[model samples]
Target: MIEIKDLHKSYKIGKNSLHVLKGINFSVEEGELVAIMGSSGSGKSTLLNILGMLDEADLGTYHLDGVEIKNLTEKTAANYRNKFLGFIFQSFNLINYKSALDNVALPLYYQNINRKERMERAMSYLEKVGLADWAKHLPNELSGGQKQRVAIARALAGQPKVILADELTGALDSTTSYEIMNLIQEINDEGKTILVVTHEDDIAHMTKRIVNLKDGVIIDDRKVKQVKALENV
Candidate 1:
């Protein structure tokens, strides 16, 4: 469902250029649950940004669901992002004043979905995330785990082809992190393609495969013995 080859990226810092990704190559098939693992400055974030179309590679190619992602106009990129990618960040990124329901409904609003359908879809996703009763609560009213659940629901509301979660459980306690990973596994069980960017070994083990990054390159990519999050929870 996704493919990349010889990807290279860099950023200019004052007079020096800092290379972030070098000759990166990989592919993710439909319905696969994978984790991209790396230490800080290992380029996992840069790779995730490129994969999410939030940034472009300075060299090489990227194909998402078969469409080459390069030189896209901002409008087109936004359209593709809405149509194909769902993002979950460590920071919930919910608007502080918006209720959980409205936050989940926000993407559908951008898609021009009508109010009735948007609310229905939003509520259904909230239900899936076990947060239906808290739908009307604002982010400040929820715990960290609850807020992240709301964020997950929001990501799923778009029905994107792929879900990209960056450090999704980084801010949570071990129990909550495992709970979130269980939700992710449940989503993957239903045949959703997911890519998680994380540095935690246990978090990466929850995925079916792990791609280890070091010094801006993929050092190891292999299938792993999947560790069900429920075991930890």
Candidate 2:
């Protein structure tokens, strides 16, 4: 449900331009779980940002669900982001004062969903993530794994077409990382497309396909046997 062709991006330094992505091309079908793996400075984050519509590419084309993504007004981009993309960051990115339930409901609030339905949907997602009992807990009150689970719930609350997770398991211990990946796998099984950006080989193996990036270009891309996270957990 996502397509990109010869994508190019660059950033200007003091006097020199730093190229971040070069001639990138790939496609992700609906319901596929893919991992983008690269070392630091390999342009994985830049690719994810462009895919999420958080940044613009300097060249080439991107199509999400058949709509060409280029030159979108800020308002339109925000609308499309809310309607089509859900993001999970390594830092959690939760408001410190907001409880897990409210944090999950935040996106729905932006969608103008009413309080009752928002809470209902939020609680259901929290339940789906196995965090229903901790719904009222604030981020500070939860452990690292719990916090990521809350983040996952928040990501799913919108029911977006694709979920983009950036280093989702980076901060957790091995056990917790596997747990989070298990949840992500379950979500993909239900037909939501997902793209995870991670450097860890084990984490990459949890996905059905891996795209390896180096020096701002995709160096390798292939499908592999899916390693079920629950087995590791």
Candidate 3:
């Protein structure tokens, strides 16, 4: 569902340019759960940002669901991002003032979906993520694992084709992390493609494939027998 070829990106600081990604070629097929592993400055975030349409590559070709992703107008980019991608962040990114139901409904609000449908879809996703009982609660009222579950529900509310998660389990306790991964695994099993950026080996192993990045290049990409997060939890 995602393809990038010869991707290169550089940032200018003063007179010298720092190259972040060099000749990176990557692809993710539909229904695949992939983990990208890399240390600091290994270009993991850069690659993810480019894929998420939050940033642009200096030189590369990116195809998402059969559409070229480069040179998109801001409006078009926003539309494509909303239509095809959902995101989960390490911070949970939930608004403290908004109730869980409203947080999940925010994305649909931008799509001009009416209030009734938005609430229905958001409630359905909340139920799917096991957060139905907590839908009316605020972020602070939830536990860390519950918060992450709410975040996951928010990401799924749109039913996007691909979900891009950055350090999704980084902030939680080990058991909580595993719980979140288990939820992610269930989602992937239902055929939604997912790409996770994580440095944690255990987290990477939970996915069906791992793509290792070093010094701005993909050093290895291979499929592995999936590890069940529920067992580890």
The most accurate candidate by lDDT is 1
Q: lDDT by residue for model 1 over 1-233, one digit each (tens)? A: 99999999999999999999989999999999999999999999999999989899999999999999999999999999999999999998999999999999999998999999999999999999999999999999999999999999999999999999999999999999999999999999999999999989999999999999999999999999999998997
Cα lDDT tens digits for candidate 2, 1-233? 99999999999999999999999999999999999999999999999999999899999999999999999999999999999999998999999899999999999988999999999999999999999999999999999999999999999999899999999999999999999999999999999999999999999999999999999999999998999998996
- C-alpha RMSD between model 3 and the true structure: 0.7
List, residue by residue over 1-233, the lDDT tens digit for candidate 3.
Answer: 99999999999999999999999999999999999999999999999999999999999899999999988889988998899999999999999999999999999987899999999999999999889998999999999889889888988888898999999999999999999999999999999999999999999999999999999999999999999999996
After superposition, candidate 2 runs with Cα above 4 Å error: none
- TM-score on alpha carbons, each prediction: 0.99, 0.98, 0.99
Clashing pairs in 2: none
**Candidate 1 backbone clash number:** 0
Q: Model 1 reaches what TM-score against the true structure? A: 0.99
The runs of at least 3 residues in candidate 1 whose Cα sits more than 4 Å from the true structure, single-residue gaps closed, are none
Stretches of candidate 3 exceeding 4 Å from the true structure? none
lDDT of each: 0.96, 0.96, 0.95
- Model 1 poorest ten-residue lDDT run: 45-54
Error of 3 at 81 (Å): 1.0
